[model samples]
Target: MKKLAVIAVLILLAMPSNGLFNFHRKAIHFNVSHEKYVPPFLFWRWNERNVVIEYFDIVRNNDSIAANITAYLAIPPSLPNQEIMDIEFEPEPDKILEDEYGQKVACYKLKLAPNESLEIGWRIQAKIYNIRYILLPFLVGDYIPPDIKEKYTRDGEMYKIHDPYIQQIVRSIAANETNLLIKAIKLHDYVIRHLSYALDNKWDDAPTVLKRGNGSCSEYCFAYIALCRAAGIPAKYKGGTYLAELPPYNDSIFHRMVLIYLPNYGWIPVDMTFDEWIFHHYAFGFHSNRFFALMTGGGASQYLNWTYNSHYESVAKLDIDSTARWLEWK
Candidate 1:
């Protein structure tokens, strides 16, 4: 983590290409300095709730030969806005490992004979809070640390930040905006205005989604993230389950949201899909207290990578029965 030394100012400079004789002027220039005016408050009063995430997973072998199975499950992580109260696992996993993206995953190993099954269940108690930041346009950090910029701004398979189409869109939408916060807001709103919620079997990247003009929730996030990155803003995805009902709920649907790195504010949550359901409002710096985050800082594959494999020539199947409910609320 990079630390500031006594209110230091960082400037972003674009270097020239090869050839010493031909010097090029910097195309991108920005400065990070102290805010001119201080607001009464920077963050709004947060609303909180307590909930429990419970799930059961079953892996079965249908072959005539014995086989070994390995599985990975995401552990509910603690964030600045969300806390993990407690966790209970039935037949505990073998080990817990952190993935490259910083998501905690519980690894389970099982050996089953022919026509046998293994069951893994767990319950996680968490306290989640709604995040609402009163962001000032100038106060939003224009300078992203080199490490974060490198990690988050890179174009991915589904995050086509470098695509000409995406770059063109971002330049048109936010090219003239000097304020990082406003630029990010413009990109976020553009995604919402252009893309309508629609179910699609194929997962499309930013350019594809933008061209279609409509996509699923994850597509909305992909498009927004790509635009933000192209505009020199650091952004990533976070996946989790949305706690929307009382206990005894059973549904396989999962939700994903974008996390944009704001200089002084840190990573802020943005959920356009959830916001659209609520009368098409802007959810740039606000998140409902109903999320059970599983992974952060990666594309959709980070969460969907869970699998069951076997060495023998045997067929295996996975089934999950999951439910989340309010444990305590105020």
Candidate 2:
């Protein structure tokens, strides 16, 4: 396996090639499992029951298969009598599977939410054999952070003695002399070196992870997003499952990673979970279509663009049916 530092150097060296920036199509198949509950047509309850709803699954055949899948369990407030109870989205799963030669092919299942506390079960499957090639350009974009962003930025300054590691990662990318791939590798290496995988620690913002240097998939993602943005590179936080031989709950199991858009190569997946896995493929040598892409972008508050939530019990809840209302409202 290539060291994270080595990969960063190579990525830096490979920049400035117009031919390198192009999208390759892929074929994909995915299955999501979660629990969902619909209030009995006429039941009037004071609190909302937890329900897990699945979203985003569409498969189109071309040069490669591409699909984005996500699910949320939330409470909905309806009428004068409905109240939401404790709602939680736990054990979220993310994965992607590709054919041996990078051809789109696969059979896989990813757990989007835990079954133990879910009221509804959800799944999405897609297969695409033909895909087209396209170029991904570097476009400057702005992301309006949710309420959480302000909190984390403040916490980062007040709680930590100036994160030297964060500064290092930002400097590497901002130098801008290196290629996009190199910038990405440096950012990925930084996270793998500084952050420890802690699936149990639920992180709602970036500062919490920066302060602890330990967190679940969300924390890792937040760090990556923060670093990339600091470098003036446009990056997005992606969540989904990876199809591997390991069990889903194993500390060794890999969940989600950040995918950055390369000027030429559209969206490329990066797995800080196993920096070695990325290095093995991007550097050392190991290739397999065992991963899949799910949801992309950060602070899932944007999901509210399509989803709505009401307090069911003192916990977070979502009412997917209101998605129509969002569209109509827009």
The models' CA-based lDDT, in order, is 0.66, 0.37
The residue-level lDDT of candidate 1 at 204 comes to: 82
Task: Determine the C-alpha RMSD for candidate 1 after optimal superposition of all C-alphas.
Answer: 12.5
Q: What are the per-model numbers of colliding residue pairs?
A: 0, 46
Clashing pairs in 1: none
Q: Number of the top candidate by TM-score?
A: 1
Error of 2 at 178 (Å): 5.2
Stretches > 4 Å off in candidate 2: 1-118, 128-169, 172-178, 244-254, 276-288, 304-330
Residue 291 alpha-carbon offset, candidate 2, angstroms: 3.4
- Relative to the unseen true structure, what is the C-alpha lDDT of residue 82 in candidate 1, on a scale of 0 to 100? 85
Highest-scoring model, lDDT = 1
In candidate 1, what are the lDDT values of residues 42-156, reduced to their tens digit? 4432445777667666666676777767666777779866889898877898987766667777777778887677777677787877555555555665566788888888878
Q: What does candidate 2's lDDT look like per residue over 1-330, in tens digits?
A: 255455434543332233233233122222212212211111111111222222222222121222222433222222111112322222332322332112111122322222112223222332211111121112212332333233223322212313565666577545653455556556666677777877773454555676677777656666776676555445554443344333221112335565554432334455565554344324211112333233333333322221112112112222222110000000
